[model samples]
Target: MGPLNVSLCMIVRDEEAFLERCLASAAGIVSEIIIVDTGSVDGSREIAKRFGAEVLEFPWSGDFAAARNAGLQRASGQWILVMDADERLLAVNEAAWASLLRQDTAGYYVKLISYVGDRTGGDYVTDYACRLFRNDARIRFEGMIHEEVVTSIRRLPEPEGIIRPSPITIAHDGYLEPVLARKNKKRRNMDIIREALRRTPDDPVLHYALGSEFFQNGHYAAAAAAFQATLPHISPREGYASDLMLKTAYALRETGERAQARRLVEKAVAHYPDFTDLLELQAILLMDDEQYASSLLPLASALRIGADVQRQYLYNSASGSGTYQTRYLTGLAYERMYRWEDAHEQYEAAIADRADYMPVWHRWPVIALLLGRTADMQRLMYAQAARLPRSAWSLTANVWMNGQQTDALREMAERCEALRAEATVLRAVALAQDGADGQAIDLLLPAASRGNSGDALLYVWALYMKTGASREAAACLKREAGGNPALRAMAGLISGEGAEVREEAYRLCQQTLMQLAAWDCLDALHAQLPAQLPYPWLPLHAMYGYLHAPFASKRELLAQCTRRFAALGYAEQLAAGLLALECGGFAEAAAWFAAAGRQAPDRTAPRIGTVHAHAAMAQEAARGYGLPALSSDYRFLSICDR
Candidate 1:
């Protein structure tokens, strides 16, 4: 029943905002508190003193270890627990702590969940650190930045000292965006890291640390270079090596070095075959290349590894390495292969595992519709409505899916009534989608009267265009354009008052047109356009309109669009080919499909389309009394189909 005699030590500078919360959380757990303030102008010192902490003022020597060691030296407890002023101890198992203290372990690894951004939905990155350790003279902190006491502990007589896992969880939010914007922490860390690297030029740990810092800052090229430099010195047995490899692969991918990234991931997977993160990355790379069938093996491997396995290093929560994520990725792979039944099963399993994962909810409906599973769709809608009862978006989507537009509009109005302008516009969009453009316009006009312009006015313009009220549509568009210069240029182009406006607003226009289902308006806009649209998909929208309004040179137009998209990439080419098939331009579709198949042989869409195209050609040839080259195409397609 005696005190465990745990001392909570912290080094802080201008951390008044978070210091009180941090100290209060550990007040009951820690027997003693040591606060080392390194030149804090704020009331951090007073805050620490208020908590009865032994406050020591240390000079700012740009060394985190020196400040940390000052606190450690003042601590009078049997055990030391190092914590930052911005971090709070969430939970601790006193029984486990007492048990661990009685053991011969030199240190304990505590779970540290650091919030990287807004923490509204538990958005955090988890890692384990040896923050709790025995209070021995040999166990002192090190490094100018990212200071650690592990190295000092490792130098003990038992170099491989037993480091046990303790039931302590710390939540840190200093890395979140709001905090980062207030304090230039990244730049400060970079400065210290550079200084340390300069002192110990060949330190692999410093290099890896620098690489991680750069990766977090979105400097992918610099991060990849630093990671590559560390690779030669990093030992495979070291815990940080796997993390280094994984981060390097991600950096390489971000830098557009996909081939190199794939090779590095594959190499890492070969060495650490059971690493679910590596396997998941491999599957993602394969999927990005459109090799859906090939991605299955890695996805299966990751799923088999499961979430129960203990991780040696830090892992991303968003990565598809966990049970729900692995199942979701497996579902995506199955869907790409056109195995709807298998895909549906995997998706259902994923939903069952983590019902609150919203991405699964969005994709599940599409799959259900594709498979014509109306009953399944209804079931999913009901389940989602139940799970996310407070989510207005989910409620709206559920009502819309159930074919209750009136109910959906009423729900939207009730749920979002506080934001009257936004709700009115949203309700109007729902009305427009339900073929009530006049009512949608009537709903939007009041907001327009109240001088609501930007998005609201744009919606009104679209409604007028949908109702064939050209004069009214133009007036609304011009009014909307008055504020957004980009819209002004686009409006001028559409109204034939100016030259073509090739800015990014074209995509927005295309999206708006698609939402309105204004196929004729899209065609009119496309005809007046001076050059090709920015995105390949934009043309497809206009082409879709031509599905009903067929033209003599439709195939030629489709072929031109397909060629343009083919030049962009395999994904775009596949999309273009599918659009062609949908528009009945079989020849153009066949050419693009063959091209895509050549680029990515494992893609099912291209292969299936090729089969359909070849079959159609063969039937036409037979009808014209001429033999077709069906055997070659059919054989290749059949192999891919299987």
Candidate 2:
């Protein structure tokens, strides 16, 4: 009935941005607030004062435990709650709070829900942190970085009953990309962790911390090495054992060692069958190698564990692996296996679980498209659009634009007034492709002159080139590029003196190339493309394969193009193989066709192309051996012709 009298304690430095949010979340619950400011130049101290916190200035000794100990010493309550400036305290277990404080327990493990990546959305990893503890003199914090009170608690007598798990959850954003950059936390933690490792050379905790720092910063190779080093000493009894194994597998995954990663995850899963993160990771590794059937096993097991594991914090598993996200992954597996209806059902379940999930949003409609349910797909698209704010029309349009779903895009343009510009660009592209070059230019010039042109300008320049005004087209493109890297790359690409561009700009280049190819502009593109490509060069190969060829000799030229597409990926294999078939290289064409057949067995084109390629190979053999060509052998001519 009375106040729980929980003391909220934290140590902060230049955390003015998140300090207020942290304090506000706990203001109604905590009896007193104690924030030890470690030489903050910001309003962290002032913000603490606003929440009626006891602000203590502590000199930065480069030891988090020391600073934390100072705050623990100042706390005057039955229980202490530790939190970071970037963390917001969630619900407290009031039912157990009084009993746990009165009973024989050193502390409680609070669930820490940390949002990963740049966006602070649904995707998060959960861990149990020792943030709740008794305000005891003997239970001060330990370790230099990632200081823990549990270590000190374990040092006391009868440690079996010392620690307990609670329903308290803390939502952490310190791991989010932008926040980590603003705080310069990755470097700080790595420096401190390395220094600690120097003192205690073979420390499992320090190595784990080092791996985490590297993993969060996208240095997966270094993270894998750090995580591997910890494996020799860590036991399953360790709090971070499952998490350590999970992270190690992910590090390998990131570094393109999927086979090794899958093996490690399988072994780890065997060791920790109940670990949801391991199960989810196992599914991912299986899916990566195109083993869709095997992937479903782990995914099903993960879902079987379900909300039971999600509700608990045994390991730092992504929050949705046991729920909607797992379903989404299952949907992917089914989709890859071409089980359209099954995939559709899983995607539906995922949407039912979390309607706003963008990953599902993109794939859900595609399933309907796959089933030839265009009307159903349109309905699904409308349902998703209805959820989004009207101001996000561009975002909605972009999803369709990226997919090149012209019909869906046109439908959206008809429904939303904000999409008129995008609709104009699409219309201009279509007009230019249909040989309406002058009309296309007229439609785009007004948008360009008014400085509102984005993709439209690219169409304008291409249309100008179509009119045989190369000089003016170059000038128009230069004006359009001005300072934009994407436009600059487009110009560079067209002039046959290409330069490297950033990834974002390169994607725009890819998108623009698709439009340019539609307008029958491959001769310029093929001549202008750089010798080396930055992947996703599908448009180049796709455009070239459609050439109205004489099927004449150009063996070396076509071979070089095939090799380039091969380097990019198997996405353009059929197109590349068809081009090879057009040239005078029967054996080479057959090889390309065979590779493409293996890549897409379900597709009729690759299979038919393979038959034609073999027929050509037979004809070439006939020429070499002085025999009748296969096409003249009436028995197989029909199969080869059609």
Candidate 3:
């Protein structure tokens, strides 16, 4: 491998913070660095110059693919390696890149390991994009936001180096910053996406991109509609349909239509059973349905499909998405089924196959701890802690799993204080949970006083709700709702505020439910709040308390609850069973857990805890349904518990 000529191509704008790092990482490897500046007032061009990159000033083009194609034209190397400013060349893949360039592969499909700041490790949301292609092969780019290099890649005349499943990866630290900035970037992107949509209404790819834009921007309703609009126009072309269908399913799920989403994915899988993207979707849906057993089939299929590569795969050029992403979903599904061993195996495999992935390490021990594998959990926690800072989520998990309450509590307090008001609402709940109500009250009251009072009131409400002060909680909510329109709307629906209020509440709930966790009711108050639309990133039931209310027949509610339980995945089955218990279906709810205990593939602690909780509730019910002696007339309420 004697100094193989490599062209380092990139399109950038205001990437001064990362340009030097990126260039330095590829310094010796690249024969030429072709930098296409898309309007940089931040001296990004100067920085590129410092790194000896050939900086070309291209007027800001709305099309990312076009800008990239322009850069490719400037690249004069035997092989072209495309990269992003915020991405770094990982040390792990250094050898792979060096070796592959010497080989006769068509092109190498490099992996991306993305990291979100303050989290544990890299996200295993891996994808294989043709980064290294023979320059004479003439690969060009297409599309806007998520552009393509189809034209240029297609020009490669020979069966050149095509590396499909190479161990090489680029470390993506682009998301390792403030979320507000990310949101702002996405907002700008939405403008372009909206423009694109207007120009091409019938394009499924555009529709999918717009839907993703909306989803990322916390605009679920619009996102869902975009995806729905693409449904009739979904491409049935062999490989492409899987990608389109998967995106649609995600949009569907985020919009609260779980059943419909599942059906769409099922159809896609039927057409392409081994499609990794569709298989990942199917696995997620199955996990939601608490059908852990059912999920195994598709997940296994995805892994097998993803791992089976004959040789280096090349992308000559297609305008739409050619990359597939599902490592996160598969690893997550394994954990949810309580198969800690399998979960660990998958996470490691995903990372080994793509080490630039950072997030998988964040949640690895969650399943390990759930399975009572304390030693394994500890080992992973410490390993993760070493790789990340003390404030990172991985380190936090280590403290939490090891029962280092003092340190974890202190760390959480710092984090809560560091976050803005909207996020501070959650800090209040954590504080309250840790028996620091005084501190919780201090952190919540000032923010709650403002009109922006999100779910802070809910934390206080939870305190009252837990202490058997329903009337007090109701009264407090009324006052809070009176002051804040959003709070009022939510209070109206849950507490029967008024007709106008209930309608408003429903709209808000619909908007915000996607960000909320799948199982908890307490966290969903933000969604149900009547304020403008709730933030889409807010996790609902996963963090909040929900009361299903009295049903006409326990059987119907039980069935509904069972399906709901199944749809959210087995990790939440316990929560669903609890709801079933509250709905007066004690035996059925208890039986659900009993079945789970036997059938669950993973041995996570949450599963074990849920089984115990359900059993205890069942035992309490067996003593007499925990029901008051009913009069001949049949009454459910007992003095309102005032």
Alpha-carbon RMSD to native, per candidate: 5.9, 7.7, 12.5
Output the TM-score of candidate 2: 0.75
Lowest lDDT 10-residue stretch of candidate 2: 633-642
Clashing pairs in 2: none
lDDT of each: 0.71, 0.71, 0.57
Clashes of each: 0, 0, 66
Give the poorly placed runs of model 1, Cα more than 4 Å off: 1-4, 118-122, 158-160, 252-267, 288-291, 309-320, 324-332, 335-423, 451-454, 531-606, 615-642
Model 2 root-mean-square deviation: 7.7
**Candidate 3 vs. true structure, TM-score:** 0.53
- Give the CA lDDT, 0 to 100, for residue 129 in model 2: 82
In candidate 1, what are the lDDT values of residues 262-381, reduced to their tens digit? 999988887788777778788989988989899999888777777556644443334345577888888888866667668878877886766665566656644554444646655554
Count of clashes in candidate 3: 66
